[model samples]
Target: MERDRNLMRDILLTLALILAIDAVVVGVFALLAYPWLTFVHAPIAAVVGTTAAPVARWLVVFLPVLALFVWAQLRFTRQELLADVPAGDATRDTHPDLHARFVRLCKQADMQPPDLAVVDRDVPNSFAVGGVTNATVVVSEGLRDALSDDELDAVLAHELAHVKNRDATVMTLASFLPALVSDDRKILNVDGGANLLVWFVLTFVLYLLASPSLPGALFSVSSVVGFVTLVAISVLGGGIILGVLTAPVVLLSRRLSESREFVADRAGAVLVGDPSALVTALEKLSDRGFELPDTDARTHYTGVDGLCFLPYGLDDTDASTDEDTFTVETRSHPPTHERVANLRALVDEL
Candidate 1:
């Protein structure tokens, strides 16, 4: 296809991010487990000398992490991807008209029709998952009720473009990294608040385990206070170090994600031969969007924000108060104004 360059570059970049995340996990766990790794160190030293033992220790942690990542990616089939994100099956038998429209669009793009899914919600949003042969387009009940037929087709075309360019699959693959440090499946920053809390607890437990005199802490209040301070210091110090290492991956993912939306906007317009329809669809969805509730389903939705028509289910929960910047860019999807502007530009060209 004409998009070969963009697709290849994104795939390479996603691979780099996956490797980098694995390295970070190994480095952190290795540092924490260093003292206890002495037994491992001794065996390696006996075979490869003391100088190489440290290198071997890191490899010991790294290899398993890399293996698990490879295994996980291979095993993450369409079934696994759809498991947490619940939806009802949509077939030609159930929705003949929708399927006919879908088939026509696929013919326009010279691709086969993907599987379809629908949700019975009042929200007018949609998302796509998997890629190529396994791809599935998911829509809400309110989407059909809210949009006119042309605007709805434009939105459908947009998601198909995502699948066509394989960006949906790329983002889906990249999501597994953030999912590692977080159970929330939040792509950006990986739910730092909860992960940090886990770090603190684990650090505290280790502090007690590594204590020089556990008997003293049994009676002394000062000893209890000292341990708390020590744990906090260690966790804080580690966060600073780890954050520096992870910043590149986060920034790159953000840049790629925003760019893909623009790419999909243009491609979708070309696919459907109607850019203005998509423009109106984008505006209506953003203007009338509702915040996603903080439920297990929301957690599932967060993982596939890049594929969703509205990022993170339109959950604009970011607190930009006091001009705080960290909470400003929570959504994996690009800003609405930017997307609209880009689509308008496409409308002019097409």
Candidate 2:
């Protein structure tokens, strides 16, 4: 009952956080559209006496935003699926015993067995991808070599729990806005700040062209230069404001992510009927000090880190590291010792 209550509380908090982030995104877009409507469309509508102006403005402002959101979600989901594809042949024939164990675990949990992929990396880590009907479990080669059958089964059970809980879909949708903003920030940094400046200038020019009050003669060389400067300042100011507003939402999302890890651990333990197996598995993985290669590390920025069995940077020695203060603030997963302790507590109750 306590576990159920914690799950319910986390779910409610996550939902509320997502809603709050959605509200902020909508509010920011509306603010951006206000100037365009007031200066560009409204005056033209007043002169032409058109009732369709409001509808037109709404479509102009919202249609592309909605389309972009849909496109982003699909694109990221595809990327996640692609990321999980086994780099080498990972068939039942390659490891019959492991396959049999996976099948048995799936049956025990009363769910269809998800496709399993073996990552060629030596990192002892695992993550779940896709949604309920299309879920895939990706395990690393190092993981297969490092653990006994019981420990490996526990790890698989954890990833499968993520699948059964539909965490992939929920996390993907919840993370869409943060990913979009984070990508934009990356682009801006890569382009030496020119991307944002160019975007703002283009937006302003488009608005000016649409406005009947602005004449083409005012678009002189000097005027154009001044307008670009003004747009750059406005864009910078808006970016700062948006960052301030969304920072808390981003932190909240991370907290929700950490909570999901605990929930998955409990669910996985229950599915396997052995919390100690998972605790042992976690300790083994941590002690090995496994790390993903640079190429694979890129996926973590895209939100896949949240789905991993352990937080990306954690190792056995992290507990003794000097960066404990920094780790406590920014680490996505809860401390390994705490998670293991929680599992041991659950074991006691069982």
Candidate 3:
């Protein structure tokens, strides 16, 4: 319970940081774009005299282009956001009946039976997805063959632990904020002709907004300055709005992810009788070769790859040195040895 509270606190702090960054970025863009947009466009309008139209006309042209950019982005990111779980048929039943046992345990724990999938890969890995209703679990073919029945049970229980704690929802929501912020940033900056087109349209809008003097009002010295101020305000206002709105959300998500990992690890240990199996599993998985094939943008890592009971390390081999001599450092997963040691301590308490 205390651990859960700590995780919540950390997630909050992370969100605060994300929000701060968002504000700064939006504020800076507003300043630069506001002035450059006005300075360049005011002269063009003076020459063209077509600037009498309302800014709304320019916004109409901008909307479709922005919509296309957003459409393409969602098409790309939708996969990571959702996964298609393979139905557990005969092949899944071959896994020594751990599935049935796990489902029973989940029932006892009052958790849902997570959608189960098994990938035919050599890497020992597993991961869970979905929230309470949509959740599913996946294990690698390699993991099934690698562990003893007890260890496998422990692994399965760990995943169920994730489901029980509602960690799936926590992680998903945590990721969503960053995904949104990233998507927005991409929308604004991506050069699929959209940014250029939007800028052109926005410039036209600014010109229109500047060109019109109030009805029956004579043009005066202040009109030009007033137009410039309005343009600056709009640009800056847009950026600030985006940053202030999105930044905290992203930061909160990341912090939640880290905390949830810790909570899941602890809860997983409790679901199974002993933490030692998890400790051992982590050790074995980390030492074993665990690389997966690369696929373009899909390379963003997810699932049990982060949670496996393994001492994750790079293969340190050298032709020039003796066959027995090697050194490995720097790992994406937390050091397995440290994790095992910690788990052992945790087990002793149990």
lDDT (Cα atoms) of all candidates against the true structure: 0.66, 0.67, 0.53
lDDT of 2 by residue, 36-133 (tens): 44454765477555787766665566667666655566566634544434444356899777788889999999999877777776667788877535
Clashes of each: 0, 0, 13
Please estimate how well model 2 matches the true structure, expressed as its whole-model Cα lDDT.
0.67
- lDDT, model 1, position 30: 54
Which parts of model 3 have CA positions greater than 4 angstroms off? 1-96, 181-254, 290-334
Q: TM-score of predicted model 2? A: 0.73
TM-score: which candidate is best? 2
User: In candidate 2, which residue pairs get closer than 3 Å at backbone N, Cα or C atoms, i.e. clash?
Assistant: none
Candidate 1: tens digits of C-alpha lDDT, residues 1-350: 34536755774776577567656755675565454344566788898988988988777766775676556644553555566557788888987877788888888988877888887767677877774357888887888888999998998898888778776556644554444334343333335689888867876666555455332564377667666655565567655655555455555666666667777888888788888999999888777745544443312334344457876452245322343323212125667888898778766765
Which scores better on lDDT, 1 or 3? 1
Of 1 and 3, the candidate ahead on TM-score is: 1
* Comparison by lDDT, 1 against 2, better one: 2
> What overall lDDT, based on C-alpha atoms, would model 3 receive against the true structure?
0.53
